[model samples]
Target: MDVAINYLEENFAERKIKIQAQEYLHRFYGSLGFKQVSEPYLDDGILHIDMLREK
Candidate 1:
């Protein structure tokens, strides 16, 4: 995870990295600088939330 993020931080020109992650993993992603950007929702019956890490 760190490796991928580091690569994006160095090479990607986008303003942020976005992901739709399992709702229960919010804290885990939060530790990596991601913040919840959307309310919880179900995707194919699994609870999920949208998050973003700004550049």
Candidate 2:
């Protein structure tokens, strides 16, 4: 996941990355610099939130 984001940011010149992170893993991703962009919501029976990281 880290390598993928890196490629998008470096090779693809992506300024923003968006993800629908599962609630439980939100903290893990947050530690990697993702920030919540939306309140938690249900998706496919799991809680999720919109997250984004800006490069």
Candidate 3:
């Protein structure tokens, strides 16, 4: 993930990364510096929350 982000940073100047994380992995991603952007919602019946990380 870091490699891809580094490449994007060099190639495109991205400012943030966004994801829809499963309920169980919120803390894991949060620990990586992601922050919640939206309330939880179901995707194909599995709950998810939108998260974002500034690059």
The residue-by-residue lDDT of candidate 2 on 1-55, one tens digit each, is 8998998988989999999999899989898889999999999999999999987
* Order by TM-score, highest first: 2, 1, 3
User: TM-score for all predictions?
Assistant: 0.89, 0.91, 0.80
Task: Let me know the TM-score candidate 2 reaches against the reference structure.
Answer: 0.91
Residue range 1-55, candidate 3, lDDT tens digits: 6786678778989889888899789998898888999999999999999999896
Number of the candidate with higher TM-score, 1 or 3: 1
Per-residue lDDT of 1-55 in model 1, one digit per residue for the tens?
7888888878876579999999999999999999999999999999999999996
lDDT of each: 0.92, 0.92, 0.87
Question: Which pairs of residues collide in model 2?
Answer: none
Decide which is better by lDDT, 2 or 3.
2
Model 1's number of clashes is: 0
lDDT measured at residue 11 in model 2 versus the true structure, 0 to 100:
92
Off by over 4 Å in 3: none
Q: How well does candidate 1 match the true structure in TM-score terms?
A: 0.89
- Best candidate (score: TM-score): 2
Better of 1 and 2 by TM-score: 2
